[model samples]
Target: MIPPAVLRRLNSLTGRSAPITLHGTVTPRMTVLASVSLATFLVAGMAATQFRSQPLPPSNRLARDEALRKSVNQLEDQNRALKTRVQTLQADVKAGEDESARRSGAAQEVKAQLDEQKTFAGLTALHGPGLTVLLHDGTDPNSSVDKSLGWTIHYQDLQDIVNVLWASGAEAIAVNGQRIVPSTAFHYAGVNILVNNASRLSGPYTVIALGDPPALAGGVGNPDQLAELKSRNRIYGLGFSWLRSTRLSVPVYDATFLVKYAQPLG
Candidate 1:
């Protein structure tokens, strides 16, 4: 309880620099109540701010978790499918290799059979140690054809020489690069003789026989063979040369012969 004149003097000294100007004296109880109310409001505001920044609700959280789980499951399924496809491709590769191996083996077997057939059929050329028979005309080109007294080699004389060589165990025979086979035959059209009906070997014929060289040459030394050759030598004036060699090549048979009287054995 201050006097009015004293209070006016105190206000005059303060000079209007205060937040609130009190006309009455301050009370302890009122001040305490005001502080408590202000503290409670600040605390409530802080709680509201914290609540606004909190995590999402249970429904939204569950939805996010379900979506992530489904994505993971889809990735796992895709990985499994890729693994299955890889395994299938590996199996296919292995199968292809096996089939190629089978085909390769079959091709080799067929080639072997074909080689054997060619050898047996005399379609393939042969080379071995044997004898060579060379026959030449006795009449030179300077001599007249009629006056030379038919001094030329005949196909019959060549046939006799081949028969003698065959009896001497000649494995293969060729006359003037002409391969002789079981179906071979000679044709005489005047002075020119066609061997095997496929080729016409001129004068100075080369008869190659593949076998034991000594045996084949000695075969021409037989009495009947020598007589057959000598008897023709007087009339035709033909020259014969029997030679033994370490290597002789017999040409391949080119003419095709179909046997109507024979069948293949199983």
Candidate 2:
């Protein structure tokens, strides 16, 4: 044990402001216990800090996953709607194309019909293999074959021949370069033979036909069909001749038709 005087002297030598006072005598066992308590305090502080910085709980994570799933569903629904819109647009486009094609086809059909009507009306010139008939006054004009001028070619004879040609499938006919149509007339104006109302025809008349060669020739030369003409041709030598041709053309009907008493049927 140090004396009071010695303690004061030690404190003065160590540069202490006050003298050290030992409340109780310190032992090695007590020093060791103080150090272990300080270590335990430091470890508990570090564990609390780590817990504060941990990940979110399971409930919070589940809510976030559900929000993401809803977003995906909305996007899928929008995708389906967009696909349907695209299909609708495509169908409309296809329908428009079909309608355009149908209109084009209808126009083409009408134009085809107009062209056929023009052909039938003799407004268009025709060319094909056919025959040409020639008719003139009978020979031996003073022979008095029947005294009724039966040897001469008349307007009635022309009409008969025209009818026969029509019946024989003549697609087109022209008498003296005049196209014969449905409205054509074969009659006599006084002594002169009038054709188509304005045109006059004389002896050696020419009849141009466009059709099958053998068929036209056969129909015209049929002995039973043209019996009277054949008889006149044999007896009085009336000029009745036909020639086949590989290529023949009929002129377009240039005469204007006067629709005085005619009307459309339908």
Candidate 3:
């Protein structure tokens, strides 16, 4: 029922061939849509897989918390042990110090006891009022008179003076700065008089006897006996003197004794 021209135009439009499309070819818009859809799907799948693979938050959190608690407990135990060890060390140190102090005290006490014994033995230097006696040789004016008289200080003379001093209650006695002890001995070595095992004496011999000055003087008593001894000295041209002093200072002897033949008394 349409006009011929109109119909022919409609036929032309309908008969026009669609653009020849190459296999596997796509339009720009279609390619873009497909890429977007593929990207979306891939991203969604990856998200789902990640969700399934991941550990639960609470489970991870609890594991970490437990590990931390265990570490804290271990640390606390270690700290306690260390504290105990330190305390033990401190106690040991204190004990050692106490022991050291005790030993030091004992040593001091022993030293004090030894000092006391020495004082009691009259093996000490004496000061204060005392008397000094001198002995001289009679022969050479510097030596004893008769060669047969054994021209040096004799053991017998020393014995006599020591006995007299002891009888006089002398507190201390020294000969040439040598303290006299109960063990002290006088012996003759040839012509020389050996006192305390050493024999080298020269006049004037000095005997420091500590006692009451008056008592010491009285103890020496016989001036005639001394005079006769002096006469013997005159034959040798030797001289002697007796001096009484109120403030005499005698030095203590610090001699080391070596006992070979005697045993110590307990």
Which has the greatest lDDT? 2
Rank ordering of all candidates by lDDT, starting from the highest: 2, 1, 3
lDDT of 3 by residue, 196-255 (tens): 665444455788887887787777765644454545555555545678898776666555
User: What TM-score fits each model?
Assistant: 0.52, 0.63, 0.47
How many steric overlaps does candidate 2 have?
Answer: 0
The C-alpha lDDT values of all candidates are 0.78, 0.84, 0.70
Off by over 4 Å in 1: 1-42, 45-81, 119-131, 137-157, 160-172, 209-238, 242-266
Question: Relative to the unseen true structure, what is the C-alpha lDDT of residue 182 in candidate 1, on a scale of 0 to 100?
Answer: 71
Per-residue lDDT for 1-266 in model 1, tens only?
33445445444544655433445655777656645664575567669879999996779879999999999999999999999999999999999999999999999999999987886567899998999888888754455555643457778778888888889999889898888877777778767778787688778888999999888878887766768567556656678878899988987898778578899889
- Candidate of highest TM-score: 2
The full ranking of all candidates by TM-score, starting with the best, is 2, 1, 3
Error of 1 at 59 (Å): 16
Q: lDDT by residue for model 2 over 163-266, one digit each (tens)?
A: 88898999999988989999999888776688778888887789988899899999998987878888888888888999999999999998878689879999
- Measured with C-alpha atoms, the lDDT of residue 122 in candidate 3 is 57
Superposition-based RMSD of candidate 2 using all C-alpha atoms, in angstroms: 10.6
lDDT of 2: 0.84
* Candidate 3, backbone clash total: 13
